[model samples]
Target: MSVRARGTLGRFLLTLLVALLALGMPLAPANADPTVGPAQDEPLPVTVNLTKITPTFADSSTPVHVEAELTNTGDETITELWIRLQRDQWISTRAQLQIVDDQQPPYAWAMSAPTSLSAPLDPGDSMSVTLTVSRDELVMYDAGAYPILLNVYGTVDGWENHVGQAAFTMPHADQRPDTPLGVSWVLPLIDQPRRVSGTDVFTDDTLATEISSGGRLENILDAAEEYGEQAKISLVVDPALIDALDAMSDGYQVRTDTGNIDGAGAEAAASFLTRLTDVADTSAIIATPYSDVDAVALVRAGMPEVLSDARTYGADIITDVLDTDPITNIAWPADGIMTDDTWQTLVADGVDTALLSGASYGQEDYLESPLGITESASTVLPNGRAIVADPGLSRLLTAAPQYAGGPVPAAQRITAELAMISLQMPTEARNVVLAPPRDWAPSEQLLDDLFTTTTNADWLTPMSLQQVSEGPPVDRGPLQYPATLSEQELPGNILESFAAPLQQVAELGSAFDPEDTDEALWPTRAALFDAASSAWRGGDGSAVSNGLDTANDALATLRAQIHIVTPSDGTYTLTSSDAPLVFTIENNLPWDVHYRIGIDESRSVGLTAEDVGVQTIPGGTRATVQLPTSVERSGAFTVVAQIRTPDGDPLGNDVQINVSSSAYGTAALWVTGIAFTALLALIARRWWRRHLFWAEERRKRADAQAHQLREDAGDHGQHEYRSDDAIVPPDFAGYDVPPRDEHR
Candidate 1:
């Protein structure tokens, strides 16, 4: 091969082998190291990250350990790599030097032998190394924070430079501030209880496991056990979860998609509740409103009644269930943002404090909230106080350790940042608050390591909410919340729209409740609150939407049960007008319902009857009501049946009946029969009178003829002998000439 071609082949072959090493494959049997190929402005083809620095504040006697990880970012294999720790006395603090020049330091601390890489690191491959500086070699004369740099020297084809820095503190005479660094570690022990459709029963065992022996909840318990009464660390809890556990204490049925299953999760949940109560006794417990209600949304949706109920009554409900007095005067809205109206409403509802986001304090830059500045203060509302959490510190405290090189490294970074806060204000002590992520999932080991590091940090003095509340306040800007309230408004409107029927259900169920504490209806109320949970953050809003759908389904079912029962075809028939229009009211609900049944005026059918006032129907029973209705010449008519609450609010849907009345009334038949009898008698009398008159006329005629015959018998009396032997004339059967002469 030509020289140039051979060189290209050599580079390609080396890269191929390094790729294999990155994939944990065997390398090719070629000269692994080649002479320097080309020069670039950036020396090293590797990235060195100083993962951690142990003993951040150490004396000469304490061993100084520097740990870092080096990754080969270049395509070629890293044939040689070395890490060196350097110290510069000219730069006492971390902020002094922004850039590192090629100029050598004026004063250099004693150097240790560079830690060598164990094996060649392939491209995209990383190796961790620990560099140590012995106490005999390094000495510290002053007590202050010092800047230390990790210089990485690596060779691909030639040597290159990569660098990072960390701060080290050597306390003066091992002395921290006499007042101590006031710190507040707020741990959130919250879980959104599962709200499945068509159920008031607590059934999921996974929830139980999460609160059981080795779950995330157990980590908080362990912290509580370790921290004892260190007043500064607080625990914020969701009451809905506690209520769910209380319900699950007995054998419970967990709802599944297909059906329900008998679950053993409740036992574990009960155990967790007991443990939580114990923790509450020792630590400050902040009970959130049941299900973490979305106050802003409720206010925007014009549901001040619901918002008031959640804030004012949640504390009592939680206390009764948990048997512990949690701080209920404080309100924590979702995303820690509430509009002015919502805030004022909460204040009116007896909320004295509100936990808000840094954004509420006009701090758009999450991490830049002024801690040491005297002007850093919480805003004051009409009847409440708003405390803005340091968003940066809160994020850093809860940041996943893996994202920041591991727990220890992340902890060290946290310590360094905290130390800088004190360093910035050596004479004054400031209160720093740390709120972990709302839905934090921490490993036991990680939690232990973090708490150990934090509690032992000489500069930090952990304070509880009670203690922090007593501290001096800082001056802050006006209250500010996110302009968008649509998310909250939508769900709130949904709940409001269904509120009346739900309230009726609650009242109805409560009446029949054997326990009489409203516990029977609490699950449904909790579900409504669940549907409005602020935990439904950015996304498609499926969580809240699903919750709303579930609630609507439940309410719809409840309303359906208290309705006018009709045929499958939704029609009714009246065989007789006398048979009062009778229909059945089916109360499918589990409690008695007092409802009024009446005709809908909008119907085309004319029906008249006394109003069927409120009737109490026992739950799960069917009752028939007979309404005396008069149909006006009806072959077919539409009867619109209305079912309503005692207050006249519509329930369910209006039932329509196609009624056909085929029976006649008795009074009208009697009157027609009497009139027909009278007319028949009158006609018979007239016929009798006419017949009598004709008979009499005939008799008179006969007598007249007999007299004539007597007079004529002497002359011609043959026709006068007998009435049956009458002679007939040709024109008039007797004597037409004689009759005519008599008439004349």
Candidate 2:
């Protein structure tokens, strides 16, 4: 080899050593520092997963994941080669990082995004590779070693050896791992913060009379104060009116839903609540500013631990309060809802569980809402179903939009806001305690005032919190919001235009909105995983054995979904069918589903054209269709059935029936065979005779008559034939009738 060629070979040898060292492959001729060319082989880079290493939490020796790129870096193609840890004692061969990056930050949430090689690398090439190495794993696996060694080998380049060195450290990826949190809030409409009992009333309805809304607010705020140490709150209200809240509660008198208190007039309900807050040792006045943090480097920022509970505070979304704290617990109050950025934030925080409450009380839907879960990856909220907000939360958020700064806010203002936001609330049997329609709450005078004055936004429609000319706080609470609502339900004359929020919270209740406020103002989330590991009852009992076999079969074949009998604490509901589709829903947690089935029918298209009876298979039985006798015994038939929820949704799809023909289904084979033979014989007999028997006899009789006619014929061309009796002589019975024909 030339001088340059020798150099290339030398470099190849060096890389070979590194590859072998990283892969932990044994070097041939153990005594030699560098092996010869014959054993040198090319090396292919492989990613090493560390999840299997199972770090004993906080063990420094346990590394998260170790990986390296070893291309032929030389002029050789790599084949199957041994790649293992440099020293078995330093790193485990079982390490795996099967989890993806987007799946989660460090919480129980599943990884949403996948990890992949940016591009293919070649010799004299480079590739950026990454792995999730748990700090504890590195510490545990390395023990006293500060750096971990990985080896890669290629037999062609055994002359060269090199090892990839990786440093050990773990980032605090997960912050609030205990729960996925959210804010619940209520908007006070009476414009006062006074706590009323069941009986108080302003006019005839509960707004003036009911105290549940106000009391719920205090309870929610207190809970947050206790649980939300790392949480920040966005309180929407007019800066000038916060003090008025106390006057509404000054009397400290017992509240009755039936009658209004004598002194609780509306000038400002502050003195009323001030006394109450003092009793609860409430600190609304002494409360600190809400907090915020950059999710990327949470640890370096000196941030407190994330809150582990759900908490909320009531806000008056009218202009004043929002002007000061535009981004309160509720982020974007647009079109009565918003869910824009809440999910992203929660995932970053490492939340595992999420709960969603309905917004409108009377307008609740039977189906669980998707809750904007479609926008977020499944890693954070597994399966994406959430609890609905209670009726209580709806009543509170309704008043904020209407209460914004107004010289004389009309009752219709409150009603309009109420109606728009009540679309998603829960129900209480027949009675739906929903927000009132636009004109429903206005007084006669207010109606007249609305028509005459167009100064404050169109009275016909409600304004979004974001549209109120106030920007949000640095760390605004996100509300579940929608980009827009269908205009079909709105009044065309109400306004020239209305633009809704760009995003909305999922049915689970959180969004990326600048003005979204929720009831209770504070909420948390959690995620837990449990496998059907014990599908086979460990104990040997009749129920256990039968149940296990059923479960095992169910898992093996997804013909049915395993539903846990709900509210039983620990239970399952196995709904099975040989059908292709199944659907259902369960809000209850801590459950896993599996199913089993056997075909009851032999075909997909069941054809009993003669009988139109509905097909019925026993519940829990698989599907089957009988093969048509008209079709050959060797023919096949398809069977189909769909599984669905009580409300009708496909579940465990891809199930089907494929029929194989056999003699077992043919009961009348012998009879059919005999009948078929007989029919064939009859057809053959008719074909062989040429159908001449009837014609031959008729032809013979005609010939006899014609013979008689010959005797009577005068002319062969025009003769009229006569019967033998007539053509022959009177005494000649068989003679021809030639004499009679002559006269004709």
Candidate 3:
């Protein structure tokens, strides 16, 4: 407690501390060599920006951009930075996906593009790349959800270094809108008029282009080269002046020739017209300014699909189904001439078409319907030496010179306009839309195969690729002689053309609404292109969830009339409150579907049990129960309709409903028996408990008697049982000999 004592204790503690420090510290003779090697072992500092994911448009071959930001964290100078993204091999499957990169191929068996890019990052810098996907692909083995490791390993001050890795995702891969885009295949009609160049003549490679934006020179060169390779197009002139083409006010419509024609020409034209009738069911062919009319008249001489011009268009066998209108188009910039002010005034004038020469009209000589789009990044057509058609003149031109006597209805015009526009797309699932296809084939029948939905997705399209019956195009010849061109070597490379279209489509990058192009536009632009494509129908941001209650009401009504049956032969009878009679739809999983519906022997209209329903599914999503008709229809007793899923599982969701009027139903006596049986079980349980208690008492008494018998039967020599842990106590007199030897 004294001050002196306290001082002594403090001194002792200080001495102890010094001794401990000496033991743990690095020890060496006064001066030794410093530790060898560089001062820092940690890699140049690296930071991966998880937020910079750049989005690509929906339906674009390219997918969402999984962007990154890298910064040098170490003092060492970073040079030749190499970044690598590896699919979490531990988590992702070898089957479910396709990864497109030099490092990782999209499909396991296919080659992927090189993903490594070389760059130098002075202590702090960044770079980016994009990955593409579709609505179906996004769900099956989605890139957005997959664990991705981006490792940045490169040379740092002459030594190999790894910048470490940061986790990131192409979050927008499915962020694309579910909004159905109106996509349609523009097929060039089988035959119109094709120019046959005997010597394989082609346009000059140096022809000037008219497309206003992007890389026009490169595009024209590419298109020309593609046509040359296919040997499908002919060049009318060296490049055919396109300068005034955009400026022109109207397009020319060719018709059948009305005047007399030579014998050979007549037969050929007639054969051509007859084939046309075979496809579209036409009555006759009208004459054109360059007509060989006698030929058309001869062709109209006979055929079943077509009728003479004087008669009806064709056979009326389609009486059962109402005929649909034809799709139409109007050529724009009617003439091959225009001024800069021309195209600028088009929006104000309500015109919607344009024509361009030195462009892709499929094969140049063919009368293919083409849509003229302004191309490129800086489409400067309206600026310098170029001229564009005034919008007002374009509209005027379409009504007269463009169509002339052609039968293009106004409604058809608007429909075509509605078919081609594209909007922003997010990479999320909500933004992806799937439209079911009734069948898969390449023909006009494809149009009817489209699925219509109340969902935001608004259109349908058929793929342009035709399945070649393991061979080349069939020669279903009319045995006709078409136009011939001078044999001049065309100037373009086929390789450049095909690749260029894909490249051009890619270069579209991101287009913005003229007014909102700055950083401030991110919120609104994000909203428009983000995944809520179906949910948010407009700029106001209305959600689809709000209308679900009404959807429930609709569901209730629909459920009432559906048909049910595992198979019409099954014995289980199912009854519901509002069933009259219904039908069922079935699907086969992963393959085709089988549908069977039982029909009433008496009613003989509409679809019957023989009719099978088709299921339209996109990859991972399951086939749904779709109501073919109202379920309230009451009819004769019937059990029908069933289809399996792509996985071969049974789903009666597609089944129809039927009335079950008490066929061998349950009885009230069954309920009474169950109640009495429970009471009897409770009584038996109590009796068993009482018996067990008495049995335990008898066993205890017997055990005690056995113990007493053993002691009485034997001498039971004196024995001591003492607690080894406890000390023995001595009585007042000396107890029998204790530990101090009694003998001693």
Candidate 4:
């Protein structure tokens, strides 16, 4: 019963399973499938993802398409799903965006008609819906920025509205009337100094690698190449950057964390320079100061000398390195803010135009249409012109194409602004200068698109810096040169710390002036500017600090080379009371060092100097200077050897010579001889006294012996008469001894 019944059950079960599968009946439990359904308490929802279908529009007659993805993101399926498009024109200008409420911006209108979805969307399911409309449908014909929103709503679990939406923009009539908006683009070619802590010259290939490879500078070069001669672009290059690259082009040395390295960036640097020269042929090349000095800080520090030196050094370095002349009539200060002192300094340096920050002007009158006024980007000064960069346009130029609203939307915002300015003036064209941030990093696609839009917009016309600067100056009001904020203010101590080296450089340059050695003076100015670079920002300015330290060290080394050669203990002994002391002067500098060998008056107590004047020592050789010194008295004296310039400026380190006079040695010898003679005389007197006493005692002993012999002879004569009387002789012997003592 088990075998037959089992076979029949198996066959029957297999057949039933096949029939269920063929009829599309689920074989697994409904709860086991992860995508089955949502919780019973959850409400039905709809989501919208908008896609920018129409990137650009020529006029109001053009059509705009916007695509959206609708998804049922709830527990149940959404039936009769509908996607609606809402349009709002951004009433606020680009300048007002920072001040306006961005969370819920003020739109012109809201809530447009709804378009039904073709099919129902189930839970975790989605469908695409394309919404098409004309430029006039959205009322975007007045040439302005418009922000569009797409909302998806559907009927799920009774009634459910749009739970999710997507926002974008559709800029219409991004063009104007007959008048074209004049736009000039200012691109910066600046980088931080390569060697922050080393010698005077740049000792690294950072700029070379940046310009030759896929880097920020390379991107800029690519843009220039793409624009060619059509776009009226101006280049503001930092001479430090060019100088650094130039240094690298010839097998330079770089200081690293560990030590120094002989760099091999010459090929890379030459390649970059070749490309740069190509771009420079067409664009208006303007060179920044040698090290991009902080103009405001320099002014605040009251360092007009440094500013003056930096200006000429900057131009000279660029001219020498690049072998190309740059527009020296303009100065672009960092942060674009310049103080009155800075303005005067620039004017004194023959700078006719100053590119400054937009905050320098009062924009309250033209907030709505800032660019409508010709003076927005330009202010007429008594001596020259101050062109304030338009912040809005700069931001637009810097904005990446992949921004929130897509490339066209971003471009259209700027285009619409330009068009507004053009529309305001049907016959008059105003110049608008746009300067990108110092380190703008935008994609090539975005830059190309912007260039295309600007070129084809027809309402905007491109102008070069030459043309812009050459135009007639507009009459403007008082100049507002505001002080930098406390946060942005550079400390006086830091500037002072760097300025000391510059002073040294100036002194050294002056000392070398009469020699007609221009080449020697070249690096001194460059090194000074390097110490005062604006790139040294924040956190104690370690780089520039290191540079200052290095400059001081270099000068110290140079000074040490021409030092006085003295004894190991820094003391020299003189055999004579007064004589000519010869001090050896060593000149290790590559060039001849002309200095005066003099005695420091305060320390020269016992010594008088003669024939101490300026003397020229050949390079890489040591010369002896015979300094005539007269000693007042014989003692220990310090002969101070100081090296000074022909004009009395200290050139190097001071040297001190400890001199022991011969008079002191002679006095010591006389005292020693007198002490020795006195000691000999005392010894002789003691010897004579002891000898006389011994001789006297010897004479008395001899006389006593003679008396004893006489007594003995008499006692013998008495003993011959009476030998038996020897016993009685004891008292007699005592008496005889007493008599002999009396005789002695």
Candidate 5:
């Protein structure tokens, strides 16, 4: 072979060999960490959950004790399970603490002796394990948060591997900082609205369970009662809830599918209210908008007045029910995000401060600071002050309780993060606000641990939300609401659903007398606010729809009470073409109603009915209205009668009336006169004819008498005929007249 061909052949063989090796090699998993444990695809034979960690903030003299639960979650049983505690170097910055999981922490500072499980752990079974690390074993530690891991080693299917691990941070303060971090916890006391709209009935009885023993609310109340004074906690209350509890305490009713039944939580409600009132004395009370209405959604839904009314009514309710003056200027949007329009609307509604999320400012660059210290929690806005909640702390507080370790691990991490912040800037004297979700349901243990951890930590000082708002301000650029946060808002479609009910409620209010408008419309207005609650965000809107339905039904029932009464015979008789059409309107409502009597004569020909001016009927009374009506001709025709509001909104059902007129029209009167005159002329002609006949008979009789006399004279001899002729005239009085058809 030629030299060039030999070189090409050798290169081709080498390239083929390289391709073959590349295909045989395994690809690494994306973003995989080998130091963590087994491969990502490997099923963990055991799961470790840290349930308790004593001395959350430890010192040189205090030893840290940890208690955990080891569960076999894999398909097969695991035997010879061992667990130990491993600690890494102290966390230097807040950023480091946040990304602790991703960091390759050597965790070689301290290691506790491994503890073994006595029996085999079957699938779906859990076992408790405790591991303690003495201060000496922990070695000399810096004053900061240290990343810790609970490592579980077990033999699964006769194979030993790192089965499971749980990571958390532990804080150690060798000496107290001169200026501790001011931690303000905003504990929410809000829930979904439970009362049915416009009635003293509840939609469900779940509220009864919520306020009872071991309930979510009960746990919150317990925390407040136990540690409210010990910690700087502020109770952010929803006035709608207080109003409901007050009503419940007074023996309210609950509506069921079958019907309304007596509620079972009167006593519990009373007790809760009493305790809450006591707690209010020690803790600062912050009133949320009535029902915790979504301000942004309300403004967008064209119901800005609802938000305003909610704010006003909420403060009043808190004062009335709890008998304590509550702070009302702070507006906390349910999702902690808002637009410029919403902010302006709130400000116009008398809000001077806002509780917002740190993410609202789009300060990710600053939030991911390396020194564990960002900007101040309080920021000065264009027209108001905003108390921004720490994103990291809020997430941990809201989401940690649901994890495997429950609130213990979360509480530990929060304590560590706070300590690291204070240690990084020991003299900065910064403040932080821990604002969880409005509907956060914290376990009893979570509350206890959080309160205990903050109280015992030397580098932390608990403060009230009010004090937090008064802290030094920082500049967090312009508001840049995240699209993800906007997605979490109560949707526009759901807010729009409330417009119909609100309009109906407004119409109902207008139907009543001016004095009764507020009393009549407040219930439905409050219900609409309930439907606009932030709690309905991310929901299917069924509850809101149900509440709206109830409001509509109540309005329908109210409107139905005022109606036009049908005549007994279902017919009206008119004595004349132009007469008054009388109708009886019955108002069954407890308040006076103003309505105009409207007559619909469209179905009748040559008939026009006048409109009766607005009439006010007293409660439980009947009023009669006379409408002037005119008809072109006398006949039977049908007209519809209905009552309407002054604004022309129809109320009640339309009534049909059959009218019959007996009076004659102008054309008929003229024809009757002509016929009468003709008949009179005929009678007079008949009388004259009778007179002429009598005269003619008289003349004929005379002529006949004269003729008879002459004949008698001519025939003197016949004396008897003359005597008969002389007597003929006299006999004519008694004699009948002879027929006069002779040619004479």
Candidate 6:
């Protein structure tokens, strides 16, 4: 036969076979309802809510008991309602466990018979249902998490369909892993800063409720107290919280909108502190930087020194309050994520160990090996090691309560996931760390179940964080910090807003004399640190802004206390151009303040004011400062006087002084000129009068001598003529030469 003819016959036979298969397949009826089952936009006829599941983990002999509630939420609910428990195949790997809901495993087993409802359920009606799967009826051989579906079947609107369903995980613990997985639980006891800046007052009284019985903090403390000895749990506490609690225990005040009132958490705070002390005595404690400050934001804001201050101050507070030296070299950034710069900053700050999320590294770089070795929980960097927490487990512990099925199912799933992880590499030991949100507040029951699961699970061995860090590290390439995590950080603008107040307070602290202690400014500095906390992330930053304002106000108040007292009548009179301008400095604070008087002479035309080099005013006293001022001309001029630190930072308000100088500037020269002229005239008059007197005396002597000479000449004319007397007669002409002539 020809090849073309054979090919045509083969194609015809294949087409006929396809047609035969299509005809044999079943087809839907013409009147079939496509919307018979649950639709996305339509409400279910019934809803199933699992209230309780006894024995979270089951064995062969253990009968599983489930208590649930069935509610008719739709408009129509008919008769013959029956509920049964269905189980799927066991989940084998973590990847499978993540998408357990998407995979429809074959039905393994169910109750002996479906439990029927006694009465027809009407709209908005609820019925309590209980189901028990006896050991004789149900059997399981696998040791992993099984997806269990609670299904309800009933006739709704004259149609029979699956009316409601609720799915959850059921752990069947029939066997144990050869090597148990090492687990570490790191719990956080952190909160926002509550104390007002630079005062013994709190911003609000919410902390009072938080520390009372059955409160968030109380529950955390209770859990630690109940489970500390049973499991290896590490508590990471914020020193800022400890500081506030200590202040509260000592009878602090709470500031309200109106005014400050006495706080009501004194007793509660005292009790909590006592219990915390006891807890710290036996448990491993890790100290967070003061207020759990946003390290990355601070570093980005150009305030890296704040990190050192926070760590040192926080460590000191923890040591003093808890009487225990906490682990200080480990840094756990909020959300377990940070940028490379933040990582480098932390490493430079002496942090040798960091608790980070598993997702922080590239996942493709560390895929599961054939031997079932997945990503390791620890990684080695250049200068430090990161204890990578399992992101899956961390989310389960931190966000379980918010799940749709609630934390009970989440707790069971946690156990199942642990079992699956252990079973993956049963022969090789692996480590995992479970870290919750920094501000987590779990209920007592949830805490109990989680702690119990860790203790009872034969495939998990609880280990300390320190022990977990010492394990071998996995190389997952460079860190891959998510952009989403960075978006959730305390913003850069808010951090920038903190710079002014921080610098102001720091300058205020520096203004103190070397011998004087600057203890007064500690609260202000702490408040500035609190403003940079990670708690302000995702918020409008109003609270943090308010905290900063309070700190600035405190510095302003302190500065206002030490100012140049304005003179009476707001005027200063200088008697001379070179007279010193005296200023009264009032130091109302309790400590000696060292400051320099800065005078603004720009407005004064011919005035020059000297800076009274740093001057110290004793506590609760006033001192006088003499600023040497020179005025070229006498007139009224304005000069601004301000109190300034030695660093030249203006402190208080500038005092404007209207200076009036009564100095005889040009008038003194005119008066001296006139007095010198009068003195010259009087001297001339005296000299002329003396000359006239001398002339008169010489004339009288001459006249008398002439008269005497005339008489003597008349007398001697008859006697004798002297040639010598005749020749000297001409010399006596306007002078008193009579004596010389007589001597001759």
TM per candidate: 0.68, 0.20, 0.17, 0.68, 0.77, 0.76
**lDDT score, candidate 1, position 172:** 23
- Sorted by lDDT, highest first, which candidate order results? 5, 6, 4, 1, 2, 3
Q: Which residue pairs collide in model 6, if any?
A: none
Give the alpha-carbon lDDT of every model. Answer: 0.61, 0.27, 0.27, 0.64, 0.76, 0.74
Indicate which candidate wins on TM-score: 5
Give the alpha carbon lDDT tens digit for every residue of 1-744 in model 4. 685476456545644544454255212121211111232243326545444456554465566677666666777877776665555434434444322213433232433346777787888998878887655445454555566556556666776544545555444554446677777878888887665322423455566566665667777778777784677778898877777776677667766777787776678877777788878788778988878877777777888777777777667777776677888888887766666778888888889898865656544223224344434355677688877677656655665333432444455456655654555555775777878777676555556656776666666788876677666655445656554332464556767876666666567654453554445555555555666677764446666566667667766655566667775777776776457778788877677777777788886776677767668887889888888766665768676778787767677677777888775343455676888899898999999989999988886785565456547758755422234422223234524455756866
Measured by TM-score, how close is model 2 to the native structure? 0.20
* Alpha carbon RMSD to native, model 6: 10.0
Q: Indicate whether candidate 2 or candidate 5 has the larger lDDT.
A: 5
As for candidate 5, its clashing pairs are: 94-372
Off by over 4 Å in 1: 1-56, 66-112, 116-131, 134-174, 197-218, 244-267, 364-381, 400-402, 427-429, 456-458, 482-527, 565-578, 581-584, 601-607, 620-641, 652-744
Name the candidate, 1 or 6, with the larger TM-score value. 6
Evaluated at residue 369, the lDDT of candidate 6 is 46
Q: In each prediction, how many residue pairs overlap at the backbone (N, C-alpha, C within less than 3 A)?
A: 10, 201, 89, 1, 1, 0
Greater TM-score among 3 and 6 belongs to 6
Best model per lDDT? 5
The C-alpha stretches of model 2 lying farther than 4 A from their native spots are 1-603, 606-635, 660-693, 704-730, 733-744
Tell me the spans in candidate 3 whose CA falls farther than 4 Å from its real position.
Answer: 1-152, 160-178, 184-329, 332-352, 355-744
Between prediction 2 and prediction 5, which has the larger TM-score?
5
